[model samples]
Target: MSREEVKLPDLPVPTALDADEEAEKNLTTAPEVPVTPYTPSAVTPWSQDSGVATLTADTAPGTTVPVDDLPIAVGVPEGADPAAIDGDWKVDLAAPAASQDAGVSGMIMRVTPPADADPAAQVSIAVDTAGFADLYGTQAAARFGMVLLPNCVMDSPDSGDCAADGGTTTMSG
Candidate 1:
């Protein structure tokens, strides 16, 4: 008759529930958020840009000269009417294809967009910075533009591997 019996009820060890007090006592069962009502997509006319084009001839290091008309600032499709998106506005300066490791001799230089910047969403080109200071000497110059949108034209044009758009400045010697 050796029994160590009859002992019960002293429970208090289940911890782990204070996610902000179960989301302030809502007792967790959340997640179903979606409010929807803004619908606005499908306005692609033209867009392909690059920046920085100063030194409009004569900073005098080697005689600068790197602004053959390049003004690009676009975005007008909300209510749409930046003057019916102005003129034909074609711009084709392809790339620096003049060989000799791109020292200048490329083609496709169809430009126009500076009649006082017309309606002003912007699109200006006239890049032919002749001899651009004996091949990039005065520093700073990069202009790669592609903006020809008659009406809803979308062509990726396969650049696949990529490395055509250019940029290289700060070379004074």
Candidate 2:
């Protein structure tokens, strides 16, 4: 005896209204969101004491203070003409000459005094920019004491592969 094959009927296609209703049902009804008006507050300047600077702001959390508003002073020594110093300042970390082969193994910021300025002049560095967090991670800027920038290194000093002949040297962070 041969068995007969049973065929199933196809589902009916949804109409436009049905589709619209389905969409409407799936959509989330936006809750009544209350809007809050922003009110500006007074700006509190940063204060420094005993080489430690404290930044205080009245703005809401996650708000960044403007870079120009930071109270950072790079003190030039007395009788040193600020005009003689180079406007282009470069900051980096350097290891001692004995540790030059080790490259910058530590976090010490060395800022180059302006060219033509007094070599013995005192210089102060302050950083309060948004990029500060990105550049130094969570490290405090005050922890980095000033040091004379060292000559560039060709490669990782710890790598033990740096060329003896002074090849093109790049400053390691």
Candidate 3:
């Protein structure tokens, strides 16, 4: 069939209202609002601490004792990116190649991040026992119990204390 082209007619435009007439017709007196004077309440200053001895110590020369250094040590790479390392991390445990031990029976990993990080941020962790099956038997890996403890200063989870804030992942293989 042959098709014929159709032309559409132009739409009519709306007329604009007169500025004076529109303003006068829409004008109305607004209700009066009551104004209240602002009066601040009296505030009391915090009291200073009084001098009181809570504990008495009679010191001698040989009263102190020292302990040995910690076993675990964490060293960041010399040129590691700060931003790249700031996040949740997971570690897999497997027997060392050079070690004569049967497999990794137990291991502990400690991670310390830079100070000034947000404490409200969630601490996520995952212990991967899949790698242990290669070195150790699958039964041993399944029997192992994993524990993660995150410590913070003042025991406050909301305080972003990076010095005492670190998480430890331990597995008893």
Candidate 4:
């Protein structure tokens, strides 16, 4: 006996959306969010009301100021009283002046070693803006001296690597 083969109808894939169905799916609705006005406050010194700086530690002898509450002094000459200075007090004006000295002609910043430090080994910070400008170009060197008392290292004494304590040297010119 021979068996007969039965054929089944192919079903359609459902991906296309009808306009009415699409409109309902993408319906516009206004969200009912509560509206409230935000009031802003001003930032003032530690003495100001509602200022963070106004809050201080209770157990201190004097006014225990917060880290952010400390005042800054700017524009005053070197060794000036910090309290007497005002207006963007943190700004530094005295940068190491550039030099053309035969040795390392650059901005020289003198740093006094601690009194207890080796008396013969004082350390002075020096920056060679010209050398930097020559090597790295002005774009990179322009802001080189902006940092206050920038740390610098020398390959040798001619580059001001020698001890800043003014030690005598036997090497002749």
The per-model lDDT (C-alpha) reads 0.35, 0.39, 0.33, 0.30
Candidate 4 local lDDT, 1-173, one digit each (tens): 33456666798888996567545566577988998864323222122111112211122222222223222111222343323222111111122222222133233333322234334421222222332343333344455452232233212333443435334343582
| Rank list by lDDT | 2, 1, 3, 4
TM-score of 4: 0.18
The collision pairs in model 1 are 57-65
Cα lDDT of model 2 by residue, 28-59, tens digit? 77899999864323222223212222223222
TM-score of 1: 0.20
lDDT of 1 by residue, 1-173 (tens): 33567677899999997456435554566788998864434222122333333322122222222222332322223444444444334343334432223333323333444354345453323443333423432221344334332211122222322224423232581
Candidate 1's C-alpha lDDT? 0.35
Best by lDDT: 2
Candidate with top TM-score is 2
Q: Which ten residues in a row have the lowest lDDT in candidate 2?
A: 48-57
User: In model 3, what is the error at residue 35, expressed in angstroms?
Assistant: 92
lDDT of 1 at 76: 29
Q: lDDT: which is higher, 1 or 3?
A: 1
Winner by lDDT between candidate 4 and candidate 3: 3
Quote the lDDT for 71 in model 4. Answer: 27
Better of 2 and 3 by TM-score: 2
